[model samples]
Target: MEIGFPNHPRRNLLKEIEWIGKNGFDFVDLFLEEDMATPEKVDVNKTRELLEKYDLGIVGHTAWYMPIGSPVKALRSACIAELKRYFRTFAELGVEYVNIHANWPGGLFTDKEGVKFQIETLKKLVEEAKEFGIKLMLEPLDTRFDTVKNISSILKAIPELYLHLDIGHTSLYGRKPEDFIKKFHARLKHVHLHDNNKSRDLHLPLGCGSIEWEKILKLLKKYYDGTITLEVFSRDRDYVLLARDKLIELWNKL
Candidate 1:
């Protein structure tokens, strides 16, 4: 399995790339978002050069704030257009998979209506992404949509859409990571690993929370052998490094 690190939108993308490379990560989950790392602001050619220099692979990540599942057709179309812009940047970077969050607009629609909106938007995205040589994956946030049954329904609606499973998110709302692995392992193409307190998505380092890392790793090994990003969000770089080491150690033991 290839391991990766994500660039925080608050930091310089080029420097983030260098740090991931120097730290021995196999790839970078390039999150093209605001405050710094927007597609218009990022230098794709230069970023590609640095990835080549480090021999690192890339997976595209979009900002979670986008209202892709907005019930309004015009607003949803605008969101899809914005996604295409990111697709162009990711395509230039040779990214194989790009992830979008399942950000359903609350109080604007019923649960059923929201799913319909999301599925419609995803269908267009999946087809358009192919033109750019990229496959789109749906990332579930901390909401009802993150449940196995709910996610499965969306996956059924769009067979081309892949799953971006975040272990940290799964730990919330009385959800078990194993349920996601067992149910959607076949659909999973990329993974995000971080620890949380089971009540909140703190993005803590592995073993520093309520998650059972050893068990999760064992199940993951049996089903997933693809790209995994250490999505830890600690201020100290040492915690990220430590999480990576701990993950490797756990995977080896299993």
Candidate 2:
């Protein structure tokens, strides 16, 4: 399995890429945010040259609050425009997988209507994404939603879609990370590995929280071999490398 990390809020894209290369990471999960690789700010050729220089692979992640299919028409339209630019950037850079959120806030729509609207918007985006040879993974965020939270409900909603499973989010539904791996191993295209206290999204290092990483790592080795981003974060910045080493050590033990 290939293991890597994402950019920090304080750093620039070039600095993050340099760190990934120096630290011997396989690929990078590009978190699209301000001061990072946002739609308008991302330079295509520069991004390509950096990736090539670092010998790195890249996958995209939309910002947590950037909901492209928002229920609000004006905001949703702006988001769609932003995401269209992002998808075009992904294709130009040869990004095969782009993680996207499942739902937006506001309870205006009923469950059935909400799912249908999300599907419609996704299908439209998928049509555009296919032209660039990109597939959008439904990131089932641990939020208040009827259809997109559970693996079973999400699969039934969009059977053709791949999943970008956040390990920490599994705790929100009272499910083990390995359970999703065992059941939907075939459909998981990207993974976000972190830990929490099972009460909130803490983004702690793997073993520092309530997660069972030994069994989780063993299950991961047995069932899946794909890109995993060490999804731990800290303001101190040193925790980034520390967490990466710890996860690698635990992963190696398995």
Candidate 3:
């Protein structure tokens, strides 16, 4: 399996790419987010050069806060337009899959209406992705739509969409990571690996949380053999490296 790490959006995009490549990661889960690393701020030509220099692959990650599911028609349209703009940059960077979080509609709509808005917004995105030859992936977040049943509904509506499974998120919403794997393993195109306390999305290193990594890795081995982003968020960069090593060890053992 090819393993990678995400660039903290608040940091320098080119510098993060250099470090990810130099440190022996297979790719960068390039998070195109605000304050610094947005689509407009990214230096695409230089970023591409660095990735090629290290022989790395790429997966596109969008800002999780984008309100694609807002009940307001204008807001949804703006979000879709922004994503389509980002897809052009991803295409230039040789990215194949671009990921977006499941949008939470909040109290503005009922669960059914929220899910409906999400599906309608994503349909436009899927069509836009086709024009750029980039596949779209949906990552279920802690929301009304986080359950497998809701996720299944979205996937059924958009047959061209793929799944981006985040192991940490599964802990937050009373859903186990295994449930998602069992239900949609065939549709999974990308994965995010991080540990959580089963109460919060702490983004801890592999062994620091209550998650049963050995069991999860074993299940993944049976179905998924693609890009996994080590999403350990810590001030200590060593934690990220330690998590990476732990993941590789457990994966090999399984």
Candidate number with greatest lDDT = 3
Q: Mark the regions of model 2 whose C-alpha exceeds 4 Å error after superposition.
A: 73-77, 104-110, 144-151
Give the Cα-based TM-score of candidate 2 against the true structure: 0.88
User: What TM-score number comes out for model 3?
Assistant: 0.98
Question: What is the lDDT for 32 in model 2?
Answer: 73
Question: Which residue window of length 10 is worst by lDDT in model 1?
Answer: 103-112
Q: List the residue pairs that clash in candidate 3.
A: none
Give lDDT tens digits, candidate 3, residues 40-150: 899989999999999999999999888988988999999989898899999988889999899867775677777799999999999998899999999988653688888
Clashes of each: 0, 0, 0
Poorest lDDT segment (10 consecutive residues) of candidate 3: 142-151
Alpha-carbon deviation at 120 in model 1, angstroms: 0.9
Over 43-111, each residue of candidate 1 has an lDDT whose tens digit, in order, gives: 988998999999999999999988888867898999889889889989988999999998776785676
lDDT of 1 at 199: 90
Ranking by lDDT: 3, 1, 2
Sort the candidates on TM-score, descending order.
Answer: 3, 1, 2
- Report the CA-based lDDT of candidate 2 relative to the real structure: 0.75
